[model samples]
Target: MADLGHSSDDTSVDSREENSSQDSKPEFSEDEETLISRMYNLVGQRWSLIAGRIPGRTAEEIEKYWTSRYSTTTE
Candidate 1:
């Protein structure tokens, strides 16, 4: 058999881990949502800056949230 980076079982385990961690992340407040929106618009998906502007959120979280909420698969 040809080598693949991960086995099917490994893929499934990774997917579950990702989903569980995502589920544990708290929802953004209305003000934080607004800030995210504004920062996104002003900087065009520059998530590090957006995360810097927000008090508690991490850049990775901000990037994921923006991608999930605003970006289409085509983009």
Candidate 2:
């Protein structure tokens, strides 16, 4: 068998750990949600700026929220 440069056991374990961690992703509080909306309106997708205003949140998280909350579904 050819080595695929990756181990199946390690990959499965890593993915399981990541999935568990993500399953407990913290929710955005009402105030944080409001702040994100206002910031997005003012900054126009500047996620880092929004994240800076909200403590304990990251730019990627803000962006994901915005996308999920506001983005229209296109088939």
Write one digit per residue (lDDT tens) for candidate 1, span 1-75.
334645876898999878866773546888998999988889986788899999878888887777667667782
**Model 2 lDDT per residue over 1-75, tens place:** 335545777788899878854853447899999999998889998999999999888898888888877889998
Could you say which candidate leads in lDDT?
2
List ranges where model 2 is wrong by over 4 Å: 1-21, 24-26
CA lDDT of each prediction against the hidden true structure? 0.79, 0.83
Q: Output the TM-score of candidate 1.
A: 0.61
The TM-scores, one per candidate, come to 0.61, 0.67
